[model samples]
Target: MSTYVVTGCAGFIGSNLVDRLLAVGHNVIGIDDFSTGQRRFLESSLKSERFRLVELDLLDIDALQRAIKGGEFVLHLAANADVRFGTLHPRRDLEQNTIATYNVLEAMRANGINQIGFSSTGSVYGEAKVIPTPEDAPFPIQTSLYGASKCAGEGLISAYCEGFGFRACVFRFVSILGERYTHGHVFDFYRSLRANPNELPVLGNGKQRKSYLYVQDCIDAILLAMEKAPEKFNVYNLGVDSYCEVNDSIGWICEALKVSPRLAYSGGDRGWIGDNPFIFLDTARIRALGWTPKLTIKEGVLKTVEFLQANEWVFGARD
Candidate 1:
């Protein structure tokens, strides 16, 4: 059984990863300050003897190093993922995402842990000219602080791999959807609908094209790559073969909730300052390794709405 230190162990993706790792009989050390992560997400993990939760922020380099001491591998998933609000707090991206990633690498180096897995995002493409951008697609000018910070994080990971003999697998993901999902457009619409089902405040023109992978599919890709794709450093774009419009998802969410809310369109091509009008990543690299998403886009959206409906408490918990 491997021992892994998963940063942001209480967040949506991190918590799900912790559960999966423990289920596979691996010893896991989870680190989180609960700044934006939910405690209830870790309840199942806490019950496992193989899992240990370290309540510490990643920015504390010394404490982070100590917490990561015995880990055989590091899964760095913590970050200020609030893309829309990034312009509001510019330093958050620098401190939380970029510096925090550097801290993870430093901690790994200090502890002699040379293997790591990083959660990166497709937003790094930054208004790409290429549709279904590939792993090798040329990077455009960074348009979002969240994307820029994550790009910086990727640079740090790559440097660590080259300089420190670290075996790194970096997965650049589009939006993710599934159980424990607490953020993004679907969650926002669901929460807003719950409060008043008569109207839904739609972001953008509702034509913003995007792609998402089911959380389970994402985890599967990660696990498969962790086993097969570490060669000094490797990069893969994790997503399905198809893309969906914001309106497509809205229909799915409302259908699941049985709500016919009036759509309030905020006239714009993009939702926020850094929101991309279209995002689709080519998953051929990961798919070549025989990993396919079990759930379709519509299925994933419906599932997310179902999760939100059953767990209305999450709305308040996030607040």
Candidate 2:
């Protein structure tokens, strides 16, 4: 079995990926600093004999090199995921997302690891003129620091592939939702409803269009890309074929929770600085590899609501 090193192993998607990797009998080295990730998410993986958890930040170059040594593949997912508040802390995205990614690449190079997978975001498209932005869609002016940082990270990976002959797979994900989801609009809306079931403050006009993929489907796409995509540097958009409006998702959540809270619009087309009003991704490339999401947007939203309802403690935990 191959040994895989997964950064951000305690975060939502990272933990899920770690569990899947270990389940298939692969040795896994998981790295996390607990800055935005939670230990509880890794509870199952932590019990596996083939799993090793390294508690350190990616910026710690020495420690990072040590963690990645002898690993055949690296799945880099750690990042400052606070898109809404990124403007509040201007340098947070740069240091956490961009710089950390560069550090990981350097560590991989130092340890002679040639394969790296990155978890990028669809926000990199910014306000794309295309309805369902394809992988080759022209990049518009980035609206958020988080998006800009991710874009920079993608560039670094590409350069590493061309310069060092490393193989790389970059998956641009739409907003993901499923079990262990602790952040994003779904979590925010759920927390607001829990705090006061009578009224809910909806961000923006709730007319913004977007796409989402269930976490399992996202993992499936990542694994498929790694195993099936034949390219020195590959890029794929991991998302469903359809899109949904923010209001529609809110409606689904409310239906799942059986709460009809008074909707309070925050008075804007977008939620905050760097918020894209439309974010539908064209998943043709990944689909060409025979990978498709299993859950629909409505089903994913309902499942997220159900998971949060059962695990209310995640709201108060790291997010």
Candidate 3:
């Protein structure tokens, strides 16, 4: 069994990936800072002989290097996910997301590990002119400091691939939906609607439609890409084929909770500063690898709501 090192292993996507890897009998080493990721996510896996958990900040160069050693592949998922937080603390955002990525890449290089799968975002497109944005889409303007930092991280990885002769696959993700999402539009809606059951705070105008990928599908594609990854720098767009409006998602959340909530606008050009209004990913590249996402927006949302309902204790008691 190949040993795989996963950063941000306690986060939504990384934890899910670890579970999937363990199911297939892979030796998995997970490292997390527990800053935003919950330690509870790794609790169930602690008993497994195949699983190793290292609780350390990626910013700690020595600890990161030690954790990454002996891994065949590194899945880098640690990042400042809250885009809005960038406006308040831009340096923290850069340090955690961008600089942390640089640390990961350097650690990979030091260990002679050549394979890497990077997690980027469609936010890199920054006010895209093209519908269903492609992987090669031009990222001229980064509306958010968060997006710009990610773009910088991607550039660093791309250059490393060329400079160090390592193979890399960059997956530019859209809004990832599924269970275990601690924060996102859906999670927020669920929390708000559950609390009030009458009024929901909707960000932006509620007309911003976006492509989303279920976490399971995202994990599957990452593995598939690992199985069939090509030499040179390979970038793929990972997202659902259909786009759903923000208001539509709100409606779905209310329907799931059996509540009719009044929608209240938070106000803005986008949801917040640096939010993309409407953008879709042209996933033909990843789809060519014979990986198709099974969950539609509605289906994914429902499944997420079910998980949230069943695990009401996750966000603390429903009251």
Candidate 4:
């Protein structure tokens, strides 16, 4: 069994990954400061004998280097993912996503861990010139600090691969949906509807296009690439085949919750600063690896809403 060190251990995706790794007969050392992560998410994994949690921030280089000792691989997912409010706190993206990623690489190098998997975002392709943006698509001018920081993180990982001979797999994921989903449109809409089922303030014009993937499917794609892809520095976009409009997802969430709140659109094409009106990523590279998402966009949306309805505590936990 392999011993893996997972940063962002208490997060939506990280916690789920910890559980999966343990289930597959692997040992996991989970690291998290619980800044944006929910402690409840790690409950299941914390119970496992093969799992150990290290409570600390990633910026503490010495602590991180010591904690990741003897790890065969590293999964770095911790980041300030608040894209809409990135302009409000610009330095957060830099410190949390970019600098934190640097710390992870340095920690790996110090501990002699050669393999690392990074969770990147599709937002890196701001106003993508190509529809269904491919892995090789030319990067446009960065529209958001969040995307820019992640782009910088990617650069650091690539440099480490060349300079240190570190093997790296970076997965650029579209917005993820499914159980333990505590953020995004579904959560926002659910909270709004709960306060007043009569009306919901919609972001954008309810027409911005986006692609989403189930969390489990995202995990599967990343794991598959990390194990099978034969490359020193591999990059893959993890997403479903199709895209959906904001209104499409809103309809599914409302249908699942049995609520038809008035859709009040904010007067704009984009929701906030750096918000892309259309984001559809090409996933042919990962699909070629024989990985397929089990749920459609509508199904994923409904499933997310169902999870929110059952686990209302996540709303308060996030606050």
Please state the error at residue 288 of candidate 3 in Å. Answer: 0.5
* Stretches > 4 Å off in candidate 1: none
Q: lDDT at 183 for candidate 4? A: 80
lDDT of 2 by residue, 102-149 (tens): 999999999999999999999999999987899999998998999999
Q: Model 4: how far is 66 from its true place, Å?
A: 0.7
Candidate 2 minimal-lDDT segment of 10 residues: 310-319
Q: How far out, in Å, is residue 203 in model 2? A: 1.4
TM-score of each: 0.99, 0.98, 0.96, 0.99
Candidate 2 residue spans exceeding 4 A from truth: none
Residue range 194-292, candidate 3, lDDT tens digits: 779988878888998888888999999999998897658889889988898888888888887889977899777577877888879999999999999
lDDT of 3: 0.86
Q: What is the C-alpha lDDT of each candidate?
A: 0.92, 0.92, 0.86, 0.92
**Model 4 RMSD in angstroms:** 0.7
Instruction: State which candidate has the highest lDDT.
Output: 2
Please say which candidate is ahead in TM-score: 1 or 3.
1
Output candidate 1 Cα RMSD.
0.8
